[model samples]
Target: MKKPVIALLILPFLFFVSSCNRGKAADEVNGNEKKQTKQLDTIVKKTALTIDTVDYNKRMVAMSNNDTTGRWPVKAPYPLPGALLPYNRIIAYYGNLYSTRMGILGELPRNQMIKKLQGEIAKWQVADPTVKTIPALHYIAVTAQGAPGKDNKHRMRMPFKQIDTILSWAKPINALVFLDIQVGHSTVKAEVAELEKYLSLPNVHLGIDPEFSMKNGERPGSKIGHFTAADINDAIDILANIVRKNKLTPKVLVVHRFTQGMVKKYKEIKTVPEVQIVMDMDGFGDKVLKKDSYRSYIYREPVQFTGFKLFYKNDIRKNWVMYTPAELMKFTPKPVYIQYQ
Candidate 1:
């Protein structure tokens, strides 16, 4: 009877050990499952948006507060435009043909200018190896300094012939083109429609400087300019149509703003997958002022992307040094678009 009782006790002990091993196996399986879940959540996936003519509004990817970058603590709510992501960043030089002192774009002829740009791009590549550099030509298609011409449009429009010449320069370097518009007294719809031919091109993009919009009949430089949310939405619609008709990649629409009044009803501006809107802080001052302006205007308002403009001469006033790329990246969501004028 004692032997039988001992045998029963041993059997129970063995069963208990087996049960413990099974529990540990279940825990291991759960750990593997959790790791897979994390990888899926963190990985940046490439998404493609289909072009639709009939249902343009339905296709935009509504984004809000993406996952942390680990590098950038402040993350944008929306997914970045697919074309300019993963690691690549755009560095552009802005200027018009009339002003030689304005920016690198107009400072030199094609060959030497490209050589200089190549050097600058190389420097950025060194500063942030993780971010690839994209070169761009931000040619001012309309100048705000001119008189209101035949149509009472104070802005000077660069002729298509000359604009084509600028576009050709991009081909040699495989750069992108931004035809910046300063409407002066003209409407955004009229201005954007004028550039339909160029905007239709794959490499050509659009930039609207509300500083020169002069919504109140004031000359562009006489007072600050403004672009209503409705005006910006109109521009977006034009770009969307161009993208759909051409079956091209996503187009970027840059709106220039430095003050609170430069853009109104900004919250009402709508975006589509076909169009990526950049709210650029076009004003330049000391590094501190620049950061404050960005924080006040851009960071406070959620947008699809952000752009920072650096005025080569103006930024150095009062012995203020422009913010370097490393420092600029410190903003909550780093600016993907960097423009130098």
Candidate 2:
């Protein structure tokens, strides 16, 4: 009889233990679910900057902060033009021609070049007062040791006289200029430092030629060099600081993308809310086919601004279809500048 009573008491103990275990398991499950929910919330918050849309052609939409109530946020419009300006049709007067001379002559006679370039600017102004001239900086040579030259011998550095000439010509026109630096043997930061004076100018800009920025034993034109996302970010940081110090309008940094690998780190290129960066499509080929290339490249990339190059004599197709100013305005991401070759 005593044994039976003990067994009954043990049964109650077992039931109580089982109930406790069940409660503990339920609490653990609830805790795990809360953690998963928190993780999902963090991921959604981090990806807030990314645009989410099924349509590729539609204008990019962004989230904006809410008004005073801070309850409902609004969507912001896309910043760039979706329809790029047909650069070939845009009038080329003064600054346009001078920009072309950048690569050919590092420095032209200031008196003659400026006078001629300014006259072209005046003529264009007369034709259309509202149109702004997109200025260019010419690429002279790489800082590397064995860049190809007109002669058989290697050409490495740009002469001081050429730098001086470019600066002198730039001062009067109140025009934007770019100091085209070929990063060969030297680092981009070093090259920028060497031309600090020019970069300091309000109207001056910077251009990098990855074509010449190859590692040792690499030859220009045979294969293009790569720029890291970090390298581009570093350059932008430097340029942004300079622009801020000078209290100038945002500086323009131009990058040429002829292949997929040229600017692989393009996303790493910093976005200074103030500066304008242009990724120019530099390939020369069929007009109709090239348009497809442009759409693929521009739409896929993170860049908002783009530039197109038109060869005056070399392009086989004449009377190419181009977007008018009105059409250009319709772009979801509008291009503020245009370039001609």
Off by over 4 Å in 2: 1-131, 137-155, 317-334
List pairs with backbone clashes in candidate 1. 65-77
lDDT of 1 by residue, 1-341 (tens): 01223434454554554555554678775665565445433331211222222222222211112324332222322322344432356788888766798787888887988887787778777766766888999988877755778888787778888788888888988998999998888888998999999999889999998888886778668778788999999999999899889877778888888999888987789867677788898888999899999878876775567789988789998999988877876676667688988
Clashes of each: 1, 10
- Could you tell me every candidate's TM-score relative to the true structure? 0.76, 0.57
- Candidate 2 per-residue C-alpha lDDT over 1-341 given as tens digits, one digit per residue, 9 for 90 to 100: 02223444454655554555555678775665566556545554434423233231232221111123322121222212111121211222112223454322323444655555455445434543344444443434334445555542232556667666655655565555666566754567767777766677776667665666665546654567766666566567777788768765556666666667777766556665345566666555666655565555543564545555544334445655543334433333333344434
Worst 10 residues of 2 by lDDT: 80-89
Residue 308 of candidate 1: its Cα lDDT?
90
lDDT of 2 at 33: 54
Error of 2 at 136 (Å): 4.0
Top-TM-score structure, candidate number: 1
